[model samples]
Target: MKQFKVIGVAALALLLSATMAFAIGAGVGRDGTIVGTKGKAKTVQELIDMYDSTGCIDCHEDAHDDWAASPHARSIYGTGRAAATMITAMKNGFMSWEYSGVKSTKDIKVEHWMGCMKCHLPQLADATDEVAVELADTLNEWYANAKKALKNPDDKKAIAIRDKHQKTLTSLNINCLVCHNRMAITHKWTDGYPQHDTVYGFNDGEHEDETFTKMKRSLIMDESIFCGQCHGMGPNLELENPTQCATAYGSYMWAYRAEGGQESCQECHMEKSGLGHKILSYSDETMQKMAIDFKVESYVSQWLDGSTLKPKAVVKVKMVNRSGHSIPDG
Candidate 1:
C-alpha cells in the first residue's frame, strides 16, 4: 500500500508539471493556431501550401476575383517594382550596413528579410531560415535576368527565368486566409486566439471548408485599426533594424481623427467606393477622383513695368484632400 501511494504521488507531480508547461506555452496564444499546429514551414512552397486559399474561390468567386486584381494578390511582386525594391533594399541597405551581418544575398535570412516582408508578406515569419535564403536567391536571379531581358529583348532564356521567379514570388501574398484567419484578431487575450480549424469574419457557425470547419466573428474587421496593423505607423522598431514603410494610419489618426473626421478606412475604400476586396487607393481612377477635389482658374491680365505695358497670364488652382489620410500615403 505504501508503494502504491508513492506511485500515485509521482503521477500527480508529473501531471502538475505538464500543466505548468502547457500554461507557459499557451501564454502567447499560438498554441492552437495553424502555425502552432502544423509547425513552421521548411521551404517557400511549404509556406505557400500552408496558407493557400484557392479553395475559397469555389464559394467566394466574386471576392476571390476582386482580391486577385488587388495589390494584395501580388504584394511581393507588385507590377515587378516591389520585387526589385526588395532586392535593392537587401543589396544597398542590408549589405552596406556593417552591423547587418549580410555580406551578400546568400547571408540574408528570415530576420534580415522581415524588414520588408513584415508587411509585404507576414507569413514569411512561419518559414524556416532556409526558405528566406531561397527567396533571396530567387529574387536576385529574377532581378538579374529581368535586367538582361530588358537589354536583350529577344532573349527567351532571360525572359523565362524572370517569369518563373515572378510566379514563385506572386504565389505568396496577403490572401483570404491571411486576412480572415491569421491576422483576423489583434487582441487575442480578449477574443481568444485564432483557432486552427476556424475562419473569422462576421459570423459564428459551421464553416463548409474542410480544414477550417468553424467561423467566428472578428471584432475589428471593419475598423480602420484593422487595416492599420500592416499599413502601419513609421518604422517597425521591433525589428533588429527598423524599416519605415507606411505612415498612413498615423496620419489618419493625427490629421483626420484628431480634427473631427468620422470616416473609417473601409467606409471610403470599400463600401462607398464599391471596390470590395479590390481595395484600391490613389492608383485606381475611381479612387483618385474620390480621394481629392480640385478647382482651377485661369485669366489674362495686363501689367506695366517701367512704363511698358505687358500681358500676363495668371493661373489659380485649389486642391483639397478628401480621403482620411494624406494624398500620397504608403
Candidate 2:
C-alpha cells in the first residue's frame, strides 16, 4: 500500500512539473517564424522578398540545384513553360486555348487562364482564399471591359487593360513553400479578405496557433492526394489543353484501388537522390529508364509492291510500362 501511494505521488509530481514547464515557456525551442503585417504580405514584392529570405538554397544547395532544373521550380518563374507561353500569348492579345471550336485567342476569357494561379502560383495560394476570390472578381471586371473595348482596333484603353493584367500575371509567381511548406495558414475575415495569422509551423507539439494543426496534418504531404489538388482536374479545369492532363489522382484511385492504393505518386515520380526534395517527373531520363523496358521484334511482311520483306527488314519496337499508374499524366 505504501509503495503504490509513493508511485502515485511521483507520477502526479512529474505531470505538474511538465505542465509548469510549458506554462512558463521554458526549455521549449523557438522555430523563428516571422510574419508580415496582419500575418499576410501586402504586395507581390513583399511575398518574393519573404521567400528569398527563407535561405532554403543556402542550406540545401544540391537540392536547390536539382529543383531549379525541375519543372516545379520553373512552373511560374525564370522562363518556365507556363509563364513563357501564357505571357507571350497575353501580350499578343491572345487568351487561352486554340481548340477546334475556338478560332482565336481573343475568344478565350482571361479568368479561364488566371485559374492556373491556384496551383502554379504558390505565393497566391499563400494568400487567404477570400483574397483570391476578390482578385478574381476584380480581374474579371477588367477583362470584360477590356474585351468590349478591344472590338475597336484603335482603342488605347483596351491595350492598356491587357498590358496591365499581363504585367500583374507575370509578376505573380510560385514559390517553394507552395509544396514544401506544410503549414500555409491564413485566416478569413468577416469582411471576406484573407488575414494572415501565422507562418509555417515547426515540429513542436503545441496548438497555440493553426501551424500546429497544419504541421500535424502534413506529416505525409508527399502522398498523391497532395498532388491531386491541381493534377486531379480535367483538361478544362484551367486553360483547356487538347486532352485531359490532370487526372493523376482519379486514375490512380480507379486503376490502383485493387492494391489498396498503397504506392505513392512520389515513390516513382520523385526519385530522391539525396535530400528527398528534388522531385522529378516520369519523363526524366533516369525515371524513363527505371519505368520502361524497350525491345525490338522483327517479322516478314508483304510490301505494297507485292514483294515479301525479309526478317529484320520489317521491324517493330515494343515498349512495356513498369509504372503502377498511367503514363503522361500531369
The top-ranked prediction according to TM-score is: 1
Q: What count of clashes does model 2 give?
A: 1
Candidate 1 backbone overlaps, count: 0
lDDT of 2 by residue, 146-172 (tens): 566668767777777766654554445
**lDDT of each structure?**
0.90, 0.51
Candidate 1, residues 69-99: lDDT per residue as tens digits?
9999999999999998998888888889999
Q: What is the lDDT of candidate 2?
A: 0.51
